[model samples]
Target: MEPLDSPAPRPLAHIPAIPIFDPLEFDRSLPSSQYTLIKTDDLRSMYREIGRVQAYLHNLINRGDDTPSLAIDDSKRAKTAAIERVPPEILSMIFEQAVPPQTDDENPRETHRLAEILLPGQICRLWREAAITTPSLWSSIYLKFSFPKNSVEKMVDIVTTCIARAKGYPLSICLWNQSDTELTQYRPIIAVLLAHSHQWDNVFIKCGGGPRKNPYEELQGAKGCLSMLRRLKVEYDEIEEGGSFDTFLISPKLRIVDLRNYGVQPWHEIGQFPLLPWRQLQQITFVGYIEDALELLRMSPILRVFKVSVVGHSVELYHVHHAFLLELSVESLVDGAASDLFGAFTLPALSSLSYAGEEFPRDAITSFVQRSNIEQSLHTFSLTLHERRDTLLIPSSNIIKCLESMPCLSQLSLHDLSKRYTDTGPFHSGDISSICERLEPRPILPKLKRFSITGPPQMSCVYLALMVKSRWRRAAGGLVWIESVEINHSRPCAHAKSSMTQIPAHIESRESGRALALLRLYRSEGLRVVGSLVDEDECIECIDEQGYGAFDPDEN
Candidate 1:
């Protein structure tokens, strides 16, 4: 790597530093109401005092002991030696926990908290020795390449010293690929870090490169050494060849891998490896897909979560053979029987399921509900229909039915009810209310704490009212509402308004007994009713004017 040109240092001013309020007093008294008023003033003064003390110390350390201007202060020296008594290994562990995350706005290599960690060391010679000996504290380095001409080589040299001092504990380095020119200039340093890939446990590398038409070919260079690494992420300028990331198949220790905007490459060659060593693999996402990605998935036994999508092609899961949990996303489920995705065998441990596609078979939805242990542990269940197909195999009717089947759901998110409006017949809110009312008298979703329905405002309001009445009768807990716009306008805006106005009327004084009983149950069961509206300008204005702005959907 090329050496960075150094700049002239600025002159320092002479000033006596002061100590602010005691940390003990501030921590003890700050939380009271009476003390809150002057909290801001106290904070400002504390900041100024800290800055002054830091500046004074910087000036003192820069000048020699013989300088008359710098006086020796030994009051903090006793405390420093006492702190120094702690072992270097222990000090290193403490520093690792105290280090803050690196960001672009400040000196990336400098740990602003380092001085505080070494404050005990600053007080005496013994503490100083211990603090400097804690090599792990300096090993975690961040190189900011924004001003390459100013900071590159200096940061590298400092980092190298830290690594040498660290002995052998792996180094955690964060390098921000700021410019292509910097990348070319610092290629050797980048190669050094990449060549020692096994040492990297957490790393984020955002570099420049266009998506290759054949994604597997993109992993040709130093990227091979990254196979022993635990976490790997590759992002290219364009995402044409998502398949090329198949080169990542070499990573046997990988736990989390994110390949953005790339197509899934065939793993025919890589698949030949003994057993896919992704025992710790929990999450995997692919933005684009080729037909053979499923074959590779079958080879990976520990995968708990997956997301795969292809624009025009259909994704078929011939068998849901995974022994653990599974999550899938597809463009369309048209014509294909949903059961085909899951073999006769059901997901025994499946806890969360979300599907977004054109349409799903009602039998498949029923089979999914019937085959799984819906009565006890199904935590999250959501299905979204993208387009109006032959007919919704699972309509709002089926959804209400399926929900009735799941008794253990604590949080539920339902979306895309517009699919119920087909060319043959129109679905209505009454049908939804009737279905909800029919739900067995048991405390279905009794543990339900947070609920969200994103669709037309009318449908959401009706569902909310019906759900409240049902929950009130069963004594459910914590109701939170999140409403978002529907993709298609199946119902008119005027109709949505009329339905929302019916909400307050539904809780009328005539049925005040039920309403009061519901309120009482909510209080007793710790239920909170939170409601919101989306796509209704009038609702937002009313909320702001009426002082219920907290529920305004615009905030989301």
Candidate 2:
């Protein structure tokens, strides 16, 4: 059907016209039937002639379409095309980009979607050669040992081919076995990755986090062959009934170990867990009981970075002192429990400390600082206080004393990631006033250069202005310590749907008088300002070095 607004097609002036007898040319004395017969015969001959012309035009169009295609094929076949002249080395570099990147800390649980086709190799013969010859193209392999038989069969072939083509390059092996109760079915695929354990640079393995057969039992063959291993991450729902994941114990080059468990695997029962040469580890992330965390600290004497989640509590109490630990992050899965766990550890070499939980843990922090001998040495501190039904909003009165202890602090971030608390924020208005007074008249956190607050400050904007002015005033007088003041606030949202972000920032609005005044002050001082707000996801700064969230284990 023609569009409603479209014009009716008019005849082209240059095209042949249909032949017919004109009414004016008919003889007045002749019968109408006789005239019609003459006109019909003459029209038949004209139609036949037009058909011949139409056929010729169609033949020309077909020939015109094929000619350029034929020429392009010849040019490529004869190596006259620019693409055909590319050197093998350059082609290999281009092929690498077409391949997916290796797994990283950001996503260790990525899956086996690349099995059906190696994109670079499937394009053409030249591309296939370049991709096959480039060992790095096959180095990053994410495979699932469980499957639909046919696709698994194809994946097996692909893995075998990649292993051969990859040559001697180290492999980043990510294997996930989810629903295969009978492990023997994929023994061939398992054996293929296990054979290359000596060249393992980084490995991520995820198995049944619940009670099930031990997936790592097949990894026994790789025990002594992991000398070249550098990073290893293994996650399970819970430790199997009568099993231990000790296959990676012999790895010497292993500096980073990530053991993520979504289980109540108690400290007493964690003996069957992975036992590594802890002293050799420089960085570690563990999600377990606090007792197990302390044990790890005691074992890893030379450990530089340790991130821990206190998922379970310890029945007995003990203290661990590490002389070489530089960074310590404690994530309390239980409310009002963060500081209690900190009471059991001391790290004199600690430079950065981060704690996220329901309570502020001021007393624990003060004693911990004194016990660890970091009162004057700690340089960076981040705290996150989430409002809970069982917790109090007011931090301890000694909270002021905690900041005074950290004289060398360079960065301080306080995040009040509360969903239900609407009228208040991380500190009371009086606390904010007290803090500003300390910054102006008294001295606290003297070396603090970067101060960031997320959520409403629960104080008038006047206190914030005074605090900034005092710090910058000192800097101008040659004290020169203050750097940046980041103010992030959220307005009470109405008609917000459940699909909206957990915490919404009204970053789009700058209409408040206080906001305008602060912007003017910042501009008048000639400070570099970024007209951007930090992502809410980034406000969880206690997890990764600058962000928070649990590392989700495999759910597929």
Per-model C-alpha lDDT, please? 0.47, 0.64
Model 1 ranges off by over 4 Å: 1-184, 191-199, 205-229, 235-253, 260-276, 290-293, 307-320, 326-346, 357-363, 368-377, 384-395, 401-410, 416-450, 454-466, 472-525, 528-556
> Alpha-carbon error at 388 in model 2, in Å?
3.4
lDDT of 2 by residue, 371-452 (tens): 8888878999987776666645452234567888888888887676443232333322433333443455556676777877
TM-score of 1: 0.47
Report the C-alpha lDDT of model 1 over 227-293, residue by residue, as the tens digit: 4455544443343323434434456566755444333333332343212245566655544333333
